[model samples]
Target: MTSSQVFLSIALPFAIIPLVLFTSSKKIMGEFKIKTWVKWLAWIATVILVALNIYLILQTVGILK
Candidate 1:
């Protein structure tokens, strides 16, 4: 259960890091590139998700309480 918890919280969300990068890259998306504001929002959301995942991992490992 602990491994499952860690995998779910950490491994799964790691994909978003690349997703945002690829989507925001003008060279990658060209005309479909994400707008600047939306790119900023995505980065902000990615940061928040990473922070929350770190918190989750810490709590699961009994380091946060």
Candidate 2:
């Protein structure tokens, strides 16, 4: 993987985590709760991150090109 991919792999999730927490937090989800759309988007993003992490590890180990 190139430097940019490596940077994104680390940065993207690091970036999204705070938003996820904020959106799902008790303070925000208490009264006017998180919308279905937001939840689905978060879930999809999380899945993508998991897949990317797996791919990056495999590439690091010479299992992927």
Candidate 3:
């Protein structure tokens, strides 16, 4: 795969997962924790990214046409 695709399909999910987790953690952010709406948005975005990554893996493995 191309470098950009590798970054988008792999590295981005890894980076965003931690960001979502950290931002949503009460212990991590204390009083500055992300708002409910923002947290939901981040979670939704993370889910989408994860789903896309799964699709990419399936395609690479020839499970997807």
Give the winner by TM-score.
Answer: 1
The model with the greatest lDDT is 1
lDDT of each: 0.88, 0.77, 0.85
Q: lDDT score of model 3?
A: 0.85
Tens-digit lDDT track of model 2 for 3-53: 787777767777777777778766866865677788788878887887888
Cα deviation of 4 in candidate 3 (Å)?
6.2
Task: State the lDDT of candidate 1 residue by residue for 1-65, as single tens digits.
Answer: 46887897888566998999999999999999999999999999989989999998988888997
**Candidate 1: lDDT of 47?**
90
Candidate 1 has a TM-score of 0.88
Query: Given candidate 2, what's the lDDT at residue 54?
Result: 69
C-alpha TM-score for every candidate: 0.88, 0.58, 0.75
Segments in model 2 whose C-alpha atoms lie over 4 Å from true places: 28-33
Candidate 1 global CA lDDT score: 0.88
Q: Please say which candidate is ahead in TM-score: 1 or 3.
A: 1
